[model samples]
Target: MRLAGAIDIGGSSTKLGIVAEDGSIIRRDSVPTSLHGEPMVVVDAIVASLQPMLDAGGTEGKPVSGIGVSVAGFLNRDHSAMVHNANLPALHDFPLRQSLKERLGFDCRLEVDSNAAVVAEYQYGAGRGSARLLGVTMGTGLGGGVIIDGKLLRFTGECAGDLGHIIVDHKGRLCTCGARGCLEAMVNSASLSERAGGRAVREIITSAREGDQLAMTALAETGWWLGLGLASLSPIFSPDRIVVGGGIAAAGELILEATRASYRTHARPEFREKTQVVGSSFEGWEGIVGAASQFLNPIA
Candidate 1:
C-alpha cells in the first residue's frame, strides 16, 4: 500500500500523520507550537515527532513516499516557504520545505494551509461530489480555499488570496494582518474567546457541548459573523457546498446552525436556496489530510 507523511503547522499547534492511498489516516498526533519565532526549533520538533511513525513501518520499504507540509501564510512565488502569516510569525520566510527534506530524508512540498484544507475536503471529505467547493477553517486565524471542477482556484499566492483578510465590517476589529475589521479579526478565536469570557477556544467548545449558556452564546455570535463573511463571499465563488473545519467547528450544529441562519439572512435569494453549508468530516485535521494527498491523490 502506498503511504505519505504529512505535517500541518498552525499558530498554536503542529499536526503530523501517516496516510494511506485511500485517504485513511494511519497515524495522527499533534505538538504545541511556540510564538517565540524560533523557526529551527519548530522544525526540529516536527522531525522528532514524525520519526517514530516513519520508522515504525520502515522494514517493508520506504515507509512513506514523501512528506507534504501545510503552512498558514502566503507562500513564496515558487511555493517554497511561507513568507507571511500574522498568527505564525516564527515560520515567516523560513525554508520549511528544504529543512524537512534535509532532516527527514524525504521529498517535501509546501502547500498553503487554506489550499490544503479545501483539497482534503474535495478529495475525501464533505466535498467529494461538489462542482464548486469553498472550505473555511477557523482557528487562531481564519483561512479559506476554493475548488472548481476539481481544480484548485489558485489565482494568487497558491490560494484564493487570503480570504480571511476580506473586509466584512469596516469598524469591527483590528486583525493580526493589520487590517481593520477583517473577516478573520471579527470571527477568529480571539473574538470568540472574548465573547465566551476569555476562555480558550477548546474550553469554550467543550463547555458549549455540555450545555453551557455562555459558551453557546459565544459560539453563536462567532457563527453569526462567520455567516456574514460566508455570505459576503457567496457571489464570487458561488459554491455548491461550503465546508467548515478547524477547532471552532467542533461545536458542530451549535455553531453551524447559527452560521447558516445568518448566511441565509444576508445572502441573495438565489444563493440562499442553492448553497449548502456543511461541517467537515475530518474535524480539525483536514489540513494534514490534504497535505498528505500531495502524494496519495495529487491534484494540480
Candidate 2:
C-alpha cells in the first residue's frame, strides 16, 4: 500500500507522521518548534525525527508518494512559502516547500493548518456528505475552513476562510490581531481561562465536570460567544454542518449546549432548523491526517 508523509507545524510543537490512505497514522513523532532559529533549522529537526519512519517504510515496501505540510500561517498564493505567521517569526516568507523538497527528495505541498483540518473532516470525518461544511478549530485562537460543492473555497491572497478575525463585537475584548471583539478574542482558551479566574482551561474543564458552578459558567459564556459567531456566519455561508475541533472542544456538551442555545437564539429562523453543530471526528490530529491526504489527492 502507498503511504504519505505528513507534517503539522503548530505554535508550540511540530508533529510528523506517516499516514495510510484511510487516515490512520501508522507512525508519528514530534519536536518542539524552534521559534528563535532559522526556518531551515526547524525543518531539519523535523526531517531528523521523520527519517526513522521514512526508512521503516522502505522495509515495509510502502514508499511515500509525497510530503504535505500544514502550517499555522498564511500561505502565498502559490502555496510555496509562508507569507506570515505570528507564532513562528522565523518562518515568515520562508520557502517551506522548496526546503522540504530539497532535503526529503519528494514532492512537498504546503497548506494553511486550518484548511488542512477542514479537508480532513470533509473527506473522512463528520463532514463526509455535507454539501457545505464549515469547520472550526478552537484553541489559542479560532481557525476556520469552508468546503462547498465538494471543493475547498479560496479567496484573494488565499484568505477566504480566516473566520477568527470576524468582528463579533464592536466594543468587546481586544484581540491579538489588533481587532476589537473578534470571535477569537471572545471564545479562545485564554478567554475561557480568564473567565474561570485565571485557572487553566484544563482545570476549569475538570471543575465543570465535577459540578463547579463557576467553571460551568465560564464554559457556557465561551459557548455563547462561539454561538453568536456561528450565527453571524450562518446567513452568509448557510453551511449545513459546522464541526468544532481542537483541545477545548473536548469539554463536549458543557460548552456545546450553550453554543447551540445561543445559535438558536441568534440565527435566522429559517436557518436555525437546518444547520447542525458537532464535535470533530478526529481528536487533535486532524491536521496531520489532512496533510497526508493532500498528498494522495491534491485539492484544486
Candidate 3:
C-alpha cells in the first residue's frame, strides 16, 4: 500500500500519522507543539518523531508520496507555507513546506486547520452527501471552511472572512483581535466561563445537564450568538449543510437549540429551509484524518 505522512499542528499539540490512499489511518501518534521555541525547532521535533514510522513503513525505498500538514493559520495562495497564525506566533510567516522538504526530503502540502476539518467532514464525516457545505469549528475561537462542488473555495483569507469575527453586538465584549462583539469573542469558551461566573466550560456543561440555571444561561447565550453568526453566513453561501465541531460543540443540543432559535429569527426563509446544521463525526481526530488525507488526495 502506498503510504503518506501527515501532521496536524495545533496551538497545544501536534498529531502525526501515516495514511493510506483510501483515507484510512494506518498508524498515528502525537507530540507537544512546543510553541515557545523557534519555528524550526518544532519542525525538527516533528520530523524526528515521525522518522521511525516512515522508515518502518519503507517509505524511503518507495518514497512516501507527500507530507500533508494541517495548521491553525492562514495559508498562502500557493499553499506552500503558513502565511499567518495569531495563536502560533512562532509559526507566523514560516516557510513550512520549504523547511519540511529540506529536512525530511518529501513533498509537502499545507492547509488551514479549518480547511482540513471541512475536507475530512466532506470526505468522511457529516458532509458526505451535501453538495454545498460549510464547516464551523467552535474552539477557543471560531474558524470556518467552505466547500462547493467537492472543491475548496479560497478567498482573500476569508471565503467567509473570519466568520467568527462577525459583529453580533456593536457594544459588547472586546475581542482579543481588537474588535467588539465578534462572534468568537461573544460566544467562545472564555465568554461562556465568564457568563457562568468564572466556571469552566466542562463544569458549565455538566451543570447544565444536571439542571443548573447559571450553566444553562451561559450555554444558551453562547449558542444564540453562534446561531446569529451562522444565520448571517446562511444568506451569503446558501450552504446545503453546516457541520459544527470543536470542544464547545460538545454541549450538544443545548448549543444547537439556542443557535437554531436565533437562526430562525435571522436567516432568510430560503436559507432556513435549505441548510441542515449538525455536529461533526470525527470530533477531535478531524485534523488528524484530514491532514493524512491531504497527502493521499490533494484535490480536496
Candidate that scores best on lDDT: 1
Per-model TM against the reference = 0.98, 0.92, 0.86
Better of 1 and 3 by TM-score: 1
The prediction achieving the highest TM-score against the true structure is 1
Please provide, for model 1 over 1-300, each residue's C-alpha lDDT reduced to its tens digit, 9 standing for 90 to 100.
899999999988999999888888889999988766589989988988998999986965758988989998889878779888889888888888888999999999899999999999999999899999999999999999999998998877778988998999889899988889999998888999999999999999899999999999999999999999999999999998999998889889999999999999999998899999999998799989999999888997
The better-scoring model by lDDT among 1 and 2 is: 1
lDDT (tens digit, per residue) of candidate 3 on 1-300: 777888888766688878777767777887878775799888987998888887877744754677888887788778777766566778877898888888877888888888888888888888898889999877667778889998887785623457778888999899877889888898877899999999877798899999999899899989888888899888777899999876688888878888888888888899788888888886556776777677676654
Model 3: how far residue 146 lies from native, Å: 0.8
Q: Candidate 1: deviation at residue 98, Å? A: 0.7
**If both were scored by lDDT, which would come out higher, candidate 2 or candidate 3?**
2
Relative to the true structure, candidate 3 reaches a TM of 0.86
lDDT of 3: 0.80
Candidate 3 C-alpha RMSD relative to the actual structure: 3.0
Give the Cα error of residue 201 in candidate 3, in Å. Answer: 4.8
lDDT of each: 0.91, 0.85, 0.80
* TM-score for candidate 2, residues paired by index: 0.92
Better of 1 and 2 by TM-score: 1
Clashes of each: 0, 0, 1
